[model samples]
Target: MSEAPFNLVYLGIGTVAWGVAGLKIRAWRRDPSPGLLVVALTIAAPATAFLVAAPVLYRLIDRVAHRGNLATLLVYLGITGFSAAAVVLARMWTPPKERGDAQVWDGATADTWHEVRRRLAVFAVLVPVMTVLFFTGGATAPETPLTFDTTFATVPQIALFLVLYQALFGFALVDISRVCFGHASRLPTGPLRSGIRLIVLGGLIACGYVLCKLIAIGAAFAEVTGTEWLSTALGPGFAALGAVLITAGFAGPAASAWARRRRDYQALRPLWDLVYRADRRLALEAPPSAWTERLAFRDLEWRTARRGLEIRDGQLTLRPWADPEVVTAAALVARRAGLDDEDRAALIVAAALRGAAAALNEGTAPRPREDQVPLPGLDAGPADERAHLVRVARYLYAPLTGEALTAAATTTG
Candidate 1:
């Protein structure tokens, strides 16, 4: 594709991906994981450049500097984002107690961080010089006609300067990627695992661009001609590939979370149906009977929260029907069967609910007792609510729990 079409596609896709990653980062910031925040900022830099700066704003600089102005913006953005990525990678590579903030360069290298600062101080001075040299080194003649004066861009020192900058940048990109991929390899097939891998892949591709530029720099110093295509086409193609992958990587966690919520919401449906019907007032909205209501997958976090909320509410309403003796009686049967703690919880709930269902069917509202064997709602904290409910659902669905309840009932009789 031509420059206009290519830029538009890249800008369009990059803007949307970066925007999604930004929202995910913002949500994470509510609790503020320092490592995640650093990674978010790292993602934000490129998103800002591709969406905000490169697509159009670079034109303002091009008015004076002409051709290489957009590249200058890229270099600055790479510097900022890469530096943050380095910090995040370093923080993640270390143990938990070691990571203080990971948002700053100082946090990454801590005892040796002043060296990073000293280099940054020097970099602050060199950036302006490099930007000036890049623009002055000149551009390929516009395929159509003259917008600015076409100066020969084979300046030896300038080529070497650009090459050195790019080489160091490639080194950073690849370094962080190594650490990220190292950790990602150990993770299971999940969003976080996949995200890290994608980011690493992007970094590796980006390193190809930097390496190509470095090679072009060598040719420039050798006074050779006819390799501009390496810098122009190959380098940027790799760069585009890298940007797309990294953006997707940043978006992985949120997408994964949403998928999990959708799955869990559906998985709990059977139990939800039973308990909600037993106490219709427990539901937040109207009955989740409508097709749209049951299948709507948006607002997952809130839905997940409400699931736990209504579940606990239902469990509380079942309190009066909960048979303490059944829970106590089931514990003995569970012990004799060598059930673990989790299985014990499941069977206890199963046995009590069985007895409760029997009494309720006979048109008897069983009286509540103070010692109710802690049926399900006592430990209904937000963090583990989903897990708690899933256990209940598992027991409710399995015929084994019903059998366990029958055995307990027979033993009690």
Candidate 2:
């Protein structure tokens, strides 16, 4: 197989790792959660491994260090670090609700710390042993970085080194695969569950990659010729494909979540404007301009949440001026017009809010407590409320809503 394809794969994986790592770093700066830090390491470690393993960087590192095959040591270290990080992440995993339970949280935290210590201890012992074994095993080999495993397998020291490294790597892959598969199976159908499933699948493929390398190494040590192709082509091929899937798996839920927040933030704009215009004091801070808001990408979840809160505050501030008669009238008009439940609710809320905004603007006397229009999602949870508010915002300028408002006014007149 051409080294070109493998080089491209390594490069692509490294690029994705850096991109995702940047996002993870930014998020950690904002939240600084332990899990987030581990997640970032999980990506950065493999990325560094692949980058150093790439033909160009492999040669550069070896040349710079004045040691042949030093890149191989670094690559193994990177892989081992990734395995440790992944296992730690799986051990620390907990549902959102369980994360809030003090007992469960404490237990998980303690267990995670213990696991971290255990893995660090293993690294301290195994890393130096692997390094000493690699250097003492052999001097310089003419084979390229891509074929180092097959070429060095005949040397007892190097073979032992490969065996030790693959043992830890394989065990971590199997452990994480099992945990991720179980968690994914129990998770409700969603982006998160799908992401976990992909990770599980990637881990299984990586296990295959490890198995292939070991098989080729054993064959080479047994004086078998031509098995180098397994290590050179088949093994690395599995690693490359597995890396792609794992990267995509991590990116999927995060990208989808960010997109959803962006959509919600944009969707709430008209409703935010309506409320802001009625009472600027309701805004927690000066609002961003339209273009700036549209272009803003960082902290989207926080921004969307804050924007929703501000809109709700504005609604509360204008509640005294809201007229229940308008909502009732609009609902009747919408029903007679045969709109669906969702559209009818949206149109009714839109008409009520419009009347409230106008009344607040005109300095009209506050309505009696009994006549005040209650918000549609007063009792809803945050997510349901946001969805309901987005619906109303969509219809805020709809022709049907405008017609309903006018008809309600005529009927109440």
Candidate 3:
């Protein structure tokens, strides 16, 4: 194949890669809501079709230029019109479900729309200006042989599209990375962490490409000739590099998913061991008196809550809420931190004692239910209650258990 055809192939491949990414994203979504699915299909289907047709269009351009430049212009205009319509229609026809039920715009979709709006405004203004310039410049006749000028006219359009495409894809990658990294804290050392790191690196590399492209565009505008070989070379090189980087970006997540499935049985062994050690230490150090304080285990509960655990039916139910293993591991850490056998025994005994005292007090006095207590009297504004709980819990369960327990007992009494 000629260089033209070879370049077309690269373009085709790049387009297909983007299409595949869209489909993959939709497929991988835990819940591919109908609206999102429509959005994905609308974007990806047209993009894929464009790629498949691009080579034929390129060949037609070459042939039609020999016959007449107007034919080439018509073709270009038609493609542009069709592409614009496709984009607008996709946005309009998106299902209500995919349109997002969010009362407030907040996540990845919101960011994508904001970018889309910005890019649309830019194109709306610039395309008209460019069209006028193309007709009036007299610098190059419409009839002038299609050389780099034809390519040049399309440059801004291509650059704009590339910018929007990168922004959307980059945002998706970042969101995914954030999720993966957030899970990393709970996960054992594994491919999940590696995947998140790869995505971060890939995003940085992609950003560099975007920066290079912007610099090239600025150079093109500043140069007297309106085009520089260096600028042109740099722009395409950055775009191609960005394409490769995006492809590499998927590697981490894909690998992580595969690894997690394959090693489910033994993957968390190290994490469990660490938990076990921490639990042992805490159990040995915590004193009986410390366990009497209501806040003694508050920190642990707070941490558990952050990790998606909950107290249900007044039982320490640890399963089906968050990752049970993670909660178990945390419990072990609390035990090893200094909570001792005496502390555990005291917790049981204190619960009974408190219940008895509460019963006797209720018989003697008109005790109000917790809910019946006036909410107006309580400071309900946002505060770091969890932090306070954690501090108290740590003090009650740590090496200073003896002192903490005595203070806690006195305060409670």
Which candidate achieves the best TM-score against the true structure?
2
* Model 2 lDDT tens row, 1-413: 46677678787788888798878788789867787788788888998999988888888888888878889989989999888888777777775445543111122567678877887688779889998999998746673678888888889999999999898888888887787786676666888788888888998999888999999999989989878878988888888878778877877788888988899899999999999998898777777888998898887888888888888888787788877777877788788889887778778878888888998888899977886767666666864788878888998888777877787778778
Clashes of each: 0, 0, 18
lDDT of 2 at 252: 78
Candidates arranged by TM-score, highest first: 2, 1, 3
- Backbone clash pairs for candidate 1 read none
lDDT, each prediction = 0.63, 0.82, 0.38
Best by lDDT: 2
lDDT of candidate 3 over 1-413, digit per residue (tens): 23464356455654765655564564549555434443344334334433433445545554655532333333334333323433332333322234353211123366556655664575466446545543443332333222323233344543343344334433433443354344435434655345435544544554554455445445544443444443344433543454454344444454454443333212222222222232333222332242243233223323333321111111111111122222233334446655564343333222222232333434534234431222110122224322222232333233343433344345456
Off by over 4 Å in 2: 95-107, 284-290, 333-347, 361-363, 368-371, 379-384
**lDDT value, candidate 3, whole model:** 0.38
RMSD of 1: 5.2
lDDT of 1 by residue, 1-413 (tens): 24574467557756786787577586666757555666666776666656533434455555556654454545444555555556444544653244453222224446445544655565566566666665565543442111111112356535645655665577668777887776676665767778878888988888887777666556656667676667666866787788788778767766777787887777677667766777788887765666865677777777767876786676767767776667776777678778888777766776676566666667776685764556743575665668767777777746566666666667668
Question: Total clashes, candidate 2?
Answer: 0
